[model samples]
Target: MRLLVSFLLAGLITDGEAQNWHGPHPWRANAVVDGRARDYNNEYFLHAFSYRHLIDRPSPIEEGIRGTAGSLTSDRLYMDFRYQQSFAFDDPDQAFTLDIQRAEDFDGSYDRQLVGFRQTLAQRWQLSLQGDVFSDKSLTDIYFGARRLHSEGSWLQLSLVLPNAYFNDKTDSQSELIDEPRTLFAQWHQQHTPWASTTLSVNHTPDATLDDRTQGDRVSSRQTRVALRYREQKGNWQLQTDLNGEHTRRQHQLDERPAPQAFRRDMASLTLAVRYWPHRWQPQVGARYFWLDEDGWFGREPNGNGEVSRQEPMLFGGMSLSLSDTQRLAPTVYLSRPRVEQTVNSPRWRDRDDHGFVGKLSVPWHITVSKQNGAVLSIVPSMRLHRFAFGGGNVQLHWPL
Candidate 1:
């Protein structure tokens, strides 16, 4: 489960060139209708690149991976690039990521490297910094962050994560694991008019970290979250709603327990969505509910009977077809049912409800109607069907690189 990989990074260059400027539309509505660059998204394409390939067999996790990424934006330099490599017939692993934002912000066989930045302070506070160096320094990582923006759709952010988590740990196999993560993000939105809208959010991470090298213990974890969202449109119908809550704390250490086990996790979720465009066709429906309440020690006040608990119910539907203006087609379906209720000395609890249903299809094509230098190319094909007889498909080609 920890076979990580990465290809090239760090002001990279060595027979693997050309990687950024933007627009690789594999979806997201075909990159908002063919990377709609509102006229040179402010001096566009200084650099942008991509190349990707992936194959996954969803019946016992067969795997393959390849990735490459590039990006560059200026006015103050910004690049968000990444690389990934992974494989399996047994074991293989890799990782990579590089980012520099406010300027704005890949690939297999790649080893590892990450660099990040985002700075802006007089015109509405902002600060960001990232790091992840490799060549095996235990695959280090330490990120930085800050943010602020107010006026109408307010904003605030915070990020700090130290990753290198999990690569070895089956109670000791040259134990290695890392997780010192932090996050605090905020948002606010309002539009009591034009249609209807309101959103409020908060995501908090209580400095979590756990480095237990089989007893060289250093455990700590705490998570947080809060959310509220609402949206509406009228005249074709479109609406969305969400409410979320999460809190988790985990501290564990065992080599025959010498006092070092504290666990607590709780989650709550709710979502509702509805859509109905109708011209180019679009029909959607959604419903979601999730809850997990259990875990002992550390102020044990969850009363959902602990050891661990879970309850999930979900259903979603979708359809979209806009076979023109850059071609499009989408289909989606989802269903989930989860129930654990509680577990302490459990044995899969006899499959815990094991509910299922999944189906997806997407076809996006934008064979440029004409445009050379500002690069544009897209082709997306994806398929998924899983229930009893699982299925899978993939085809992606995003130009540049």
Candidate 2:
């Protein structure tokens, strides 16, 4: 229902003694178009741009830029564009994408200036791709893979993505060692009940060299999750409970080492919340129990270290009140064990048993700026105070679209 163009530019100008004019110049822009075309027809478009400049004295600082644009047509035609600067060579950025498909048109456009296609026949499967070209090295990464949706509600999805590559000037000396990294991933999702869900995913990144010493090796990460939620709603009182468990594993090489390091972590949490909503005010109280276990080498320690575990309990309470139709106020309080942890061999391990309290409050005012443009803006001011934290402050901002 709204088409908005947003732009942001930020840069840091430093004045050091020797490098008097040095810092990073960063800028970003985003454009979003959303509206309904006709009955039951929706269209949307999004564009984003980001640029960063690194400045040095004797030599000019490197400049890098990235841009992306995507749109969903009224007739289900989806298109995307992506480009990134190559700081090593003064070359224009590249762009690519997968072409739109119709029921009968499979061999569509392969225009060199605007689009191209590639087909690969692997031992087990076939892959088809098409995309536009901006420069020689940069191309849009696209792929499609699907799996069966079984009768028991289990579904699987497999996909391969070949993203664009940008030359890193810092590691240009070792460019030969760094290869372009590609990602392969598979995910499975299942719904066992109305209040329960499970997901399993695995992601693999092939060896991509950034430098000779850091010849990136194939890394694989896997995650499995199960969550259960229960809610009871009666009149003005509500009760809810959510429980979840997750396990993750990551394996990767470091510093051209042949042996790969593996890390595994497990986490489980349970939260119980109760709320009462009246005509003008709503109050909620919640408590959570969390447990975490981590094992294996984190690449810092040469010899593999044993596992570590932590348990924490947290309590939270919040309330919201509506002063009028266009104004609201909310405040929340949280108490949790300190996040600092001590290793078994550390000398000050006893200092990890502390607790802290955090309090936050927010108020929002909705104002109608224009009637013809249907413009409405909400301004919110928030503040956070932590008893034992390092920084505390208040924030005020108008919500941007």
Candidate 3:
């Protein structure tokens, strides 16, 4: 924990001019606790803390803390802290940012730390470099990413990540278990017309895997994804379409032998919406179509010779209304056909031929605490109801700085 704290503190110290001395520093804290009596028990608790200060005339320090505790059938606790300092260059468009984050569990158990730097290269280009280290674990990841924007509201970006995993020989059975995972990704966005915009992105993870025998001999897992999205706004109507394709390969080593398993998924969706605003009454109608294709791994094969494939389609709609300038309400309904039972661990498991509908409603109210200083606050309470799915309620608070 000391090493993690040191890494974060080192990034916070930089040369800067000290302006007006402020007593302590400005800070704000917020917390939310919500519970609902559904057929099944559910509850959530969240807390956040924020602080900001001027380190110098042209440098500022910012920090935040986030924690969550709750039970959705299982109880979990999480806490994270972050600090960053921003310094300005001679040019207004150019600046440098150093950031650090540390996170741990309630019992001071598992911990992780990240330190990074961000720089504005030019008018439309930016770069970031980060390293993540873990406590009680000998694994580290170094990531480099960059973003660039064109003049015509178009932009492109790319990222490269390298992961290095190490194991301690004293307590571990394997003398040295080292696994390296490398990843590359790229994306672009453009506006085709005044009312239309499109985004295309592709990701490739060629070497992401685990090579520890004690970890069940998972080896050589690769994944690729390609996605496209288009949105158009015309008059009081809006149309959107999204398409995505994903392919994954996993190999398991049994007795030092490798066996290949693969899975591919394809999805497409289209939505059309129309809004009519008349005085205090605002009504919106929406229709949607969704299609999914799951191919390859489905379930444990008898002889490991055949592949499983399935398809599904879905429809959805929603509407909303503005109660006043400071208050609004909205509700949405969705129906979808499930295909294949998907789990976090195995891609082969998926749901098949299931249809259900879910509804969500939200109402938000705004209040101005001070008119002279333009201080405002908003509160929103929302609920979700599903016939064949899980539902919950949430409350949100917002304040402008």
* Candidate topping lDDT: 1
TM-score of each: 0.29, 0.42, 0.56
**lDDT agreement of model 1 with the native:** 0.39
Full-model lDDT for every candidate:
0.39, 0.35, 0.39
Q: Report the C-alpha lDDT of model 1 over 1-401, residue by residue, as the tens digit.
A: 11111110100111111221111101011111111121112112212211111111100011112122322222322222333222222312212224321112111111234465555667687666656565554445555656576654345555555444323422234544354344445545454544454555555655555454544445566556666666555666666666766565656554555886666667776767676754455666777666656454322112111354556566656565666655455444545545544344322122132333334333434333323311223344433344343122223322221
lDDT per residue as tens, model 2, 1-401: 01011011001110011110111100000000000111111101010000001111111111221111112222343221112222211322222322321110011111222133323233233233433334544333334444445434455656555543333432233333235545565656554433233444554544443222333333444444445444444456655555656565656565556687676768776767776755355677777666666655433222233445556666666666666655545554545553424233322222232234434333333343443432334343334344333222222112211
Deviation (Å) of 306 in candidate 2 = 9.0
Maximum-TM-score candidate? 3
Error of 3 at 323 (Å): 2.7
Q: Any runs in candidate 2 off by more than 4 Å, and if so which? A: 1-221, 225-234, 238-245, 252-260, 299-309, 338-340, 344-401
Residue lDDT tens for model 3, 74-182: 2432223334544567875555554444332111223334566667766788787766655534456566878797855567878776644343433245523234456
| List of clashing residue pairs for candidate 2 | 96-140, 178-209, 178-210, 179-209
In order, what is each prediction's RMSD in angstroms? 23.0, 18.7, 14.0
